[model samples]
Target: MRFTEHEMTVAVDTVARRLHAATRPPWRRGDAVAAYDGLERMKKWRLKVTAGEVVLPVLTALPERPTVGAKPEFTEAELTAAAQTAGRDVMEHRKPGAWDAMPAKRRDRVLATAVELTRVAVDGMPVRQDPDALIVPDHL
Candidate 1:
């Protein structure tokens, strides 16, 4: 979720300072506090799309099911983990709504670019290759 100018400023002012104080090894108390605070205020965030033509709801309600799918190939645990890592990426094609508008192409372009960027960013993260590791989430 994206924050407005006012919201961004307020978050930086209120939570950023608390985060600095909790800096410690193994556990960042301040960071945890800031995360908790952000969760408390998650509702205030809005969905950000540059096109702004399509009106999508800014806030999301709690999902009905913790895991969406437990059928076919993916299990409940896999679905839960996937959902936790990547929240609803549901996007509608604006072309269906647009009536021969020039901006339709632009909207599709923006959506495509956003998806590509997300893919690149996710791939760019460093993968842990601990040879001694036996479990997927041993630390957890």
Candidate 2:
């Protein structure tokens, strides 16, 4: 799908936020790196397909930007620790930048694209009505 620069930028942020929220303790060494790689690929795809270059946004404008503040309430380590405490499966956190697999910023975009894509069926049907086809494969 075709995505504009602003869309990509906002998307990356969303993924990063969710990733941060989903962090787990004792993360792997290169998770961040892996996530970033995923984001880059997403950006390329958006640029290439021009999915709905002039349509999606008109359908739904993103919500108001969050308020800026001082330093974040939780660092990566803190979030990881929290995840562990909450019994969340931090190992499966799949945003681009949450770990070394990706930079925090780009991860958001990647996630947005992923979620956006998975919402659709392969046959061009809305996924909410037919989600079986959007299933993702497990990683090694």
Candidate 3:
């Protein structure tokens, strides 16, 4: 999900413009102007893409019950034990696969899904205050 070269260029330009814009409130804000200058001086700023990583949130295809095709009906205790084992399996570690080596079409789909899930999770989060108010300074 790391942006392609073209995307990176556009994003950097947009961010630079926004930072420059932030310095222009009617207020006498020295810090805002300084920060904007500092950002311009930076030659490199890395933007990580979490969607590039494998092991994305899976919303389907849970394991089938262990007793699905059992020859004999299991006792209540046995069923309870199976459920506990399944719960523990959820906490097990699964190693990451080679996402970069995947086919372009498949990788695109996976990254797209990850981005959508990320958007949903972010949208559902609760904020203590309005973000715009905190990010932008008021005029004096």
Model 1 reaches what TM-score against the true structure?
A: 0.22
Model 2: per-residue Cα lDDT at residue 105: 67
Candidate 1 weakest lDDT stretch, 10 residues:
53-62
Report the C-alpha lDDT of model 2 over 17-95, residue by residue, as the tens digit: 3343345345545475355445566654553344343223311332232223221122334333332322212223445
Residue 83: error of model 1 in Å? 17
lDDT of every model, 2 decimals: 0.33, 0.36, 0.36
Which numbered prediction scores highest in TM-score against the true structure? 3
Per-candidate TM equals: 0.22, 0.21, 0.25
Candidate 1, residues 1-140, lDDT tens digits: the string is: 33234433433333333323333255644465455445433322321222111112211111222222221122334433333223223332434434334375665554444333333222232332333455577677
| Candidates ranked by lDDT | 2, 3, 1
True-structure RMSD, every candidate:
15.3, 18.9, 19.7
Writing each residue's lDDT as its tens digit, candidate 3 over 1-140 gives 22224433433444434435543675755665355456533332321222212111221112323232221233344433433333233334342334434576875554454334333322322332322445555763
Between prediction 1 and prediction 2, the one with superior TM-score is: 1
Mark the regions of model 3 whose C-alpha exceeds 4 Å error after superposition.
1-97, 129-140
Top-lDDT structure, candidate number: 2
